[model samples]
Target: MEILPGEGVALVKVGEHRDVVESRIGPPVHPGRSSRAVYETSPMLVLTYTGDETVELVELADGDGDGGEEVFFDGVQLTSRFMDDVVADLEAKGYEYEETDIGYRFEPGFAVFSMGSRWARDLDPDAAEDDPRRVVEGVSVAPYEYFAEPAEEEIEAYISSRQSGGNR
Candidate 1:
């Protein structure tokens, strides 16, 4: 599954990208740009969380793998690798995730932080607090946190680093 990165992360985060998205971008990294993050699955829907206190519910597709095809919501095809990244970030925060029949879910916001209401009820209400992988439309839900800010040194190294080998 080819998942599209939040189409305007940079634009939405830094430049003029509001027309493409709904929520306002978050902090220095833009504090709230959880635009609908739909994934290709059996029952797809608009998933988003732009640093809001409550999650919003929108009736989208019925999960048909075509979620990625829709440009209206900036569909990002959910894949195992994507889930791996989410798990990695969560694990960094000392969180453990259990694989589900769906995709992947975690705590402390990221992916599991703001799941669609239709997607939220699938799991045990008690499961939300303890579960790392909440069920969303029969699929595990996760965040494409790959767009998140990197560590300071990492950022510095990247900013200072330059292309060396050109014709070599």
Candidate 2:
């Protein structure tokens, strides 16, 4: 997809939606409500798919802030590198993909982005769940709360600590 360099998405408000929000990029996509379209401006092309509601993504091509191309992921090449340094502190992780061409749905996770900045990893739950980019037919739905539920081991650990008369 070759979204125009200056293409961007309008974060819609909840409870206000167009019955037929259309998009035409490389070809005829999203001719009706039966499918949702995710329009990308930078990298170009809108992805059309069959699903519930409109959860599309504007795929931005890697570019500099000046629209000169960007490098999406820079460092950390191999699994070994992450496993040795980063993965050690992690537990209970899996992937759940939203079946849409627009954007992706990350259940039980968080994102952080400033007013004029891009999103980043590990967002504040209260804040991330309130991202303006997240909406369906003008209705803002609740974002999946990451780390809301404790794993079994974490629960057991908590119990053990309390029972052991240790500081909580």
Candidate 3:
């Protein structure tokens, strides 16, 4: 799918019909609320639909919790190589973005660009560590605290640790 600027995404407008979204993308894995729903097109790629029936956002759960989620405009199956291409395309189109430890946050209009890897811990309270699948599998796009800004020290530490080939 081609990503147009803020005007329209994929084949659907930012705030358009739900049927178009379903037809283009397919039904969601979980039941939706009156206002929003989430679709897991792949283990690592997720799509968000608003109450108004527009595809609001797309998120990629990176290996660590630092990068920003992005506004998804079109459907694309994700793999390591495919993600790189998508990010490059978004950049080529002049999508303004910010860097984080985990990923990049593109400037968003249809949806907020931000990271969700941190939320993996919440899904398994008793586990010794976050399930790695949480970052590689699907994630919920609900409004949550996972997107909060990290402290400067925390960000620096994460980068340093990653650079040193240490686990975070």
Candidate 4:
């Protein structure tokens, strides 16, 4: 599968209706209540819908180590690669990102999370930087608003505070 960032996967795009998605990929493996659907594709596909039933978020997650499928973003393979390597490649491509609690959130609506160890809720701190535990586990794409900055009032407040050294 290929991620289109602020758009959607190659098979579906954000803002597409649920029926359109179902027609292209068939029915979801498990229909979620109201606003979500899960499909049993190569790398499992999950779609979140808006109140009007249009796709709002698209997620592709790595399946078992059996290598069920592969996923890519802008031609760069995402699944199974080390987290740092992926970040480096993205940076090289001029994609700016912010480190999230789980992984990295890139501009224009792309985010990836680490898998971590099965026994731990978070990544194992003692694991080597190159450890497999740090490979990307899942990737998500959404509309620009999903990664947009706060409201203008909030931004102005923050700017004013910073200028006054209130936050320092």
Top-scoring candidate (TM-score): 4
Model 4 ranges off by over 4 Å = 31-33, 115-133, 148-168
Q: Deviation in angstroms for 124 in model 1?
A: 36
User: What Cα-based lDDT does every candidate model obtain?
Assistant: 0.35, 0.30, 0.45, 0.78
TM-score of 1: 0.22
Q: Write the per-residue lDDT of candidate 4 for residues 14-74, one digit (tens) a residue.
A: 9999988888889988655567789778888888999999999998986535666867887
Which rank order by TM-score, best down to worst? 4, 3, 2, 1
- After superposition on all C-alphas, the RMSD of every candidate to the true structure, in Å, is 14.7, 18.2, 14.3, 7.7
The most accurate candidate by lDDT is 4
What ranking emerges by lDDT with the best candidate at the front?
4, 3, 1, 2
Instruction: Answer with 1 or 2, whichever has the higher lDDT.
Output: 1
lDDT of 4: 0.78
Q: What TM-score, computed on C-alpha atoms, does each candidate reach?
A: 0.22, 0.23, 0.36, 0.74
